[model samples]
Target: MKKLLLLLFSFALFGLWSERNVQSVHASTIASERLYRLYNPNSGEHFYTKARLEKQQLVALGWQDEGTGWYAPVTGEAVYRLYNPNAGDHHYTLSAGEKEALVAKGWRYEGVGWYSAPSNADYAKPLYRAYNPNALAGSHNYTLNKAEQTYLTSLGWQDEAIAWYGVNLPSPLIVDLSEWQSPSKIDYDTLANQIDGAIVRVYTGYRADNNYQRHLTELQKRGVPVAVYAYVAPSDTLAEINAQATQFYHLASSFQPKFYWLDVEDEYLSGGLTDGTSIRDAMESYRLTLATNGASKIGAYIANNRFATFNLDTTKFQAIWVPTYGDNSGYYENNAPDSTENFALHQYTSTARLKGYDGSLDLNRLSGQVSFAQLFS
Candidate 1:
């Protein structure tokens, strides 16, 4: 009788261990599933998916991979996916009532997108929602970040409350910076942690920006990556271009910029010289001068609408930087430059307001898979 009793006790312990192990395995599986996020610049739309293939397809179709938006579970409440045929945008929700409501308003229910976590689940996190009242397409926005939701509302976006529950939500990578965000204007200690890289203005076409050296020394002291750019006047004589580029290299070389960008704007043709030939000549002069003066990585900062009109060679430069602010709302709406120029970096917004900084900043992000090392190297 004793022997039988001991065997049964051992079996009960083994059963308990197996049950806990299975539960842990399920939890791991749920946590491993990530909801990939992407942005459509042309359409101002954001997309999320649990399918790697779909994410890859959209990325291949020119979408910006915004990385994982949140984490889903192996099984829970079904999140329905809907498509507005007329607007050409996608929407997802966890409520059957909300799904039907949009469907009734001409949104075709594609099917269940991904599973949401159970209410008040320990691993679950809230996904905040927002709506752009001014937009007819790509109106709704969802994020797992409360700060981002708050920022959007400050920019005229309406808060729509928590859309669903997820296990993980990541901070968006907004690494690029510029001269406008200076030590006097913003906290350097905070800026150091926030900046991935910065491009300070050397010359603004007619004269040098006074903060160029100060910004450089500050960034260098903090071990922050730095670059230099000079705004070139379109009607600038070959002599002026040569002198400015040379002066820029000589003074700024000690700080060791990763790239020397020539800012060529069509709007700043000195003396109203709109000749495309003169513009191209001025651009080329600055580029060639920089190259001759030992600047290894020369980049061109061109306005999106000036690609054809300015007649830029583009092949002469190592990298292309284009500015195209979709709404100029001071936030990146993933608006790609409307140009044929094959660009390496994008200056998305000139009015970005970063934490610790009170003034507007020109923010940039790399195009496609381009990296800091590749641009500099």
Candidate 2:
């Protein structure tokens, strides 16, 4: 009887141990994200991302992923990422003052790279930063390892102290961009942390936006969902409108973007064209052509209060994105879309001077019941 009781006690202890261990592992997985680190030997730049694919692709491109980095939590404060266009270097910080100073000095804001662990929290780890005074492209390196930090300083790298703590990630908003952002060499990795998804201008009329390819490539590489839009030009006939759709789709097909949108924002499609029938007819043609070409989804981007004027059959589209800048105030969330007409995405501001890119960005949000997964997938 004594031996049997002892055996039962042992089983109880083992079960408790197993349950705790399982809970610990599960908590870690659900509560944190890994910030992958990579080093570019050619550029002498050390890069970090919460994006696994971006890290993997860079490794394939000769950037070395030499094992490990730290895990970021599911929630924390912001650490701003900035890129120097002239110097081709990048910097991260938690100070809005420093970020603004850098922007004033011409460093393009790359948005929040990652959230930092709370400074006041005891469980937080330190991310040591070092600067190489001579390097042009990758002048700074950040690491969570104390030994590596000490070693860099021993080699004469200027120790910048803890640049910021890294703890987490999520995507909540959308932005539409064009050549206006100067896309060729911007920091998409850091910018990716800020946006849930993106809608990029593929072309403005017959002329392709120079930024589309690089924008789509970098954003996709960072695992951000992308959609493409074309600013419509006045079409002389249905054939021209159909050609526009075909051309945009062909240009956009390789990327397999989330959505294709006809951006009808100007009065150029007006003059002689009636928005009710003629323009609607052209828009319908563009929408149908895009769909027939295998676009996963189709949307219409129209000016605020212009949806009814377009006389578009709203039921035909998968989504409708409307730009409604209350006063073009260059601020976001200060005002919502004025027209209560049908719209899935609200482009709230054209002058959203967000930190990620140097120029003003067009900020947007999903309306009603729209969500990131539903829109992108």
Candidate 3:
């Protein structure tokens, strides 16, 4: 009897172990499936279900798996550093007075700089490290425009372009418009001759721009390549996002401009939502919906202040347009932060005056490989 009892106990233990092994395998499979990001372009929703049946169901309903939606988080707390061979390395404390004092002390103000680092387990991919020439002991420096670089070079400081980040030295001149500016007197040929391309606001929320079609017609008439943008105001729910995407697609598809941009700003997504990650997810859904339907050439137009405040991941968009009014004048000016990529298009001034128009216009500068002619083709 004792021998029989021992044999039964051993069997019971083996059964428990086998069950635990099966559960572990099951859990791992679920985790892997959850990591595979999926989006429904038609519905403007994101899904992370691990069930094979659920995935099949979504696929039948026009869901697209966008792979992983994970990205390396970039912290914006790095300081723009300055170095002096004589006085040593100094970091700017976000104080104009402190920077001026450093300049007075003959310290060379290096552009936005960061410590060079290799890919870690957390990042997996190579994280974007700021380019620092000196590799001196201090925090990274900020970015400098052509004007700022020229000024630093004049002061006998070495100027080397960013190692990884490449931007066109001088940005191509361009302009953006909406219904607010009356360009009735404006000649399309003259405007095209003056600028490389044009970006216009096609829709603001659910309301289509009053003059989007007219503006596109005029631009096309003059052989000018044009891009269009729709202002996004995502609600707390996925259904609301789908509605916005549907409205925007119907209006923007008619023109078929070179690029389609989602303009996220001014309490649009932030009005009702407080979670930055949720807002990011909502915008991603909006972009995905546009891409799946027809607008594949998508980009983002976000101001510097809002971009940082919202902690947006610009990498998701094929291109980025940033507006920064440093000088706040008619002339184009740029003071973009070095921490982020120097956008594809920079709206340097919103109050620029041109010969063909009476009121002020938003002026932009195209950098890198942003081609005006290619966009039309």
Candidate 4:
């Protein structure tokens, strides 16, 4: 009887301890949920998930949440919150203007915000909006129109004159050497001497391998500014493109280019990766890498066709080089509707004569539409 009683007591104690442990775990989970809830104490609003917070509805109103479920920072009358999975039960707040701006840029705010789950669980990562560097009517576009004309007038530009004059306009010209039949044969010294200041070109492995370094060295010797170009090929996979970018990064570091151009044109369209989402993703990744690698200060070169298809965030890139060639009038049509804010460097003549090149190559002149500082600085 004694032995049986002792055994029963032990069993009861074990059960009680187990029950308490279970209760403690349940309580901890409940507390954690509350602690992690996206709350803005300042705004007196709380969000259960990140999806709820990122909604276009919320973003437009300028809602922001503090990660601690504390007070949210408010701008105007709105408050915002964003759930961060990496933060583990933390919420972040967005200003009202930020929300409105995001919505205006075309972000779909929907779904449960974010929650902590098992590491193995699959969760949708947040998608960032695309960056369109060349918007039809932005301040840069407006400046391009006035600056180019002013510079042209200063350079003794006549209505029918085909003379080239140097105005020290401080803007880089958008040039493509792809059409150059014999880049190797051309005298780098002659071309460098003709162009004042910097002469930017699209540099690729194909071009870089074909005596690009030697040509760049020659251009440098002539005291002309040099920039390299990276063509984002459509046929290239993201991995391949990224690897290419890494190569460019090393080269840019060594060359110390004034700027780098992301040339997305024929090569991009010719290959299969034309889907908007894929293009956007690749662009974002590339941009992020550039930014991370301290190459964000560089510029981007885009043609009319790619400009129309991909929505680029102008804020991410420094300047836009647009190609629109035409008659002697020096006016060319852009794919997008005409606006004062269009392009910084406009390729008005593709068949312009160069001293060394046998055939006409894609020639572009600096448009005084905007000050270089306004477009780049």
Candidate 5:
């Protein structure tokens, strides 16, 4: 009788242990089935997941769970997003005046707002057409939005009420090089692999960039796309403007660069040329001289804030490149220009650190309708 009782007690304890172990396993499975929200505070990005195990997996790969949260769909309001085919940038605005102003300046409405709720994706309807007679074989210059027959009567391009063939978004990487970046120090192989193209400094006033030819040769050897820019100083006379343009033309014409840009910063405007009218007239002379010398696709490189100080006539150049370093270093949204259409190229960051390079470099993005291929083609 005693042996039987002891055996019963041992079996009961074992059963209890087994039940507890089973309950613990069930609890873990339930926890694994819960939902989570992972957030990256640094980049202000958020992600959602239903599996706790999946969340844990992402956490292991450098994500943090902000906590339990539900996903809310954003209901998009109908607003216009204007696109400039010449400059690869878009402007989102609700004002009719703003929209009309952009249309006059050659921006095409893509037809829908960006904030449409996920369930009902809004598609842009083609109402008008934009054409660029000067555009190359495969260029965005040939396309525009909406019916602009009346508007077309005043402009240079033909308004064909046809949809664009296709959108070929260009690779956005572009690097600017000057005498400061030596040819011997540049890792052309790495640079070519990393970037879509390069804009090399040809001359500043009458002095040529010492590394200009060597850099051009390296890029050409690597099959990298190339462009050229010349730094300019404020001049009161057409003679001085012609001298700078002549110097720029001689070096620039040899390469037949994809594009030519004039570097005009606040320093040039500050040297006793505060009168906006004078500044506009001075730039016109330079532009005309370059055109006469056979420099194709001319552009201007200036700071956004300085645009008003100089009262520049931006339409004079084929394109504009603006430098707006968010901080003193120059690459952040805080420093972006007030008007996106003012610039075709935005040199947002000047302190970009590339691998195998000793110093910081200027980084730029295409804001205009033109692309790397379009500019080259």
Candidate 6:
């Protein structure tokens, strides 16, 4: 009876051990499928998941699952995973301390087959950083007359020439009617014919004016692109700014200017208001406001010195219009190199000879001197 009892006990113990082994195997398989193992070639570090790697790298990094034969997110790469039986060999056993160490070294954790990163993981891609928001404003200093336009064309200022004088023509000076002494005196038909394909800028504020309306009508009739400029009050509260913007939106809805320009020159005159918030915070607020309001394109018009002096975050603005005179050469000539990189256009070369309705106006010119396509692209 004793011998029989011992034999039964031994059999029960063996069965328990076998069952535990099976559970362990199942757990490991599940973990393998749920976690993606990554090895950083540069750091010679292995990560159990992409999240583990990202926390360490602060950059977009990724890995692949060998068992699933899937590629994972990496620096500048999209997030995707695959499954392959061969990936089993890629798996590495790691202790808690090892995992922590890997994460500390900029490794990220990600899932294996049929698993994905957490929804809130920072999965944003890096974009081309803007260099200077006010780089293009200085381009307005040059003349857009026939000779000047031709010279600009030679220097690859095609977009500026078109925006200023209309068609990419080499000759035929189409005077800006608004700048004429008697805009109404000039025959609409003659002016239209001259500016058959010239682009024009119109100031469209909340205040209604016949001159602005007439110009809008004529420009629409001529199929020329029009852009509105609003002299924004920097100190104005959000409500006041929104009111002004809404008014402009309604008025220009029909005209549909390509975009709106927030003229931010003369900080004092326009209620010099600078947010005490950090530059990043201020810029973020501005950008969010413009974006939420559905402004197709928003730009800033700042003077050269102001841009240089103010530690403004230029990235918030789509494009910057720097008001510098004469070829934009010496506009920010004395200013130090800008660290913030956000610029699309440069308003260089203002012609002092031209006059607007109010008085001698600064005829600003833009140049393709900068890589605008790359900046905005």
Top TM-score prediction, candidate number = 2
Which stretches of candidate 4 lie above 4 Å from their native place? 1-175, 178-184, 197-209, 235-237, 267-277, 328-341, 369-377
Per-residue accuracy of model 2 over 139-211 as CA lDDT, tens digit each: 8888877899899899989999997654322225677878878864356766676566888888777788888
Candidate 4 per-residue lDDT over residues 5-73, each given as its tens digit: 564465456557867764321111110111112333344434433232243344456545332221111
TM-score, predicted candidate 5 vs. hidden true structure? 0.52
**Model 3: ten consecutive residues of lowest lDDT:** 25-34
lDDT score, candidate 1, position 314: 92
Best by lDDT: 2
lDDT of each: 0.71, 0.71, 0.56, 0.43, 0.59, 0.38
Runs in model 2 with CA error above 4 Å? 1-171, 271-277, 327-330
Summarize candidate 3's per-residue lDDT along 1-377 as a digit string, tens digits: 00145644654665587687643211111101012235656433344332335556867778785533221112222334465656344453334466668879888876543222122221122212232444443223223235654565565546554322211112345678788765675755545544556788878876888888888888878766788888876565776776777788888687778688888875656643544336777788788888887887888888767876666677888888777655343443346534366477777655554434555567776655466554444
TM-score of 1: 0.54
Q: Tell me which of candidates 1 and 4 scores higher on TM-score.
A: 1
Model 1 score (lDDT): 0.71
Superposition error at 219 for model 5 (Å)? 0.6
What C-alpha lDDT does candidate 2 achieve relative to the native structure?
A: 0.71
Q: Residue 368 lDDT in model 5?
A: 61
Q: Write the per-residue lDDT of candidate 1 for residues 1-377, one digit (tens) a residue.
A: 00145644654665587687754321222322457789999999999887767887999999999976875664778989999999999988888998899999999999989788766654467889999989877899999889999999999999999988865322222334444455678666555544556788877666767678887787678776788887765552567667878887887788778788887774655333444336666777778888888998998887777776678789998889887766444444657777677798887655444444656566677777467776654
What ordering of candidates by TM-score runs from best to worst? 2, 1, 5, 3, 4, 6
lDDT head-to-head 3 vs 5, winner: 5
By summed lDDT, the worst window of 10 consecutive residues in model 5 runs over 25-34
- How do all models score by TM-score? 0.54, 0.55, 0.52, 0.46, 0.52, 0.40
Q: What tens-digit string does per-residue lDDT give for candidate 6 at 251-359? A: 5557766656666554453323343343334334554565576666777666666665555566666666654333222111222224233443444322212111222
Off by over 4 Å in 3: 1-171, 234-236, 271-277, 369-377
- Which scores higher on TM-score, 1 or 2? 2
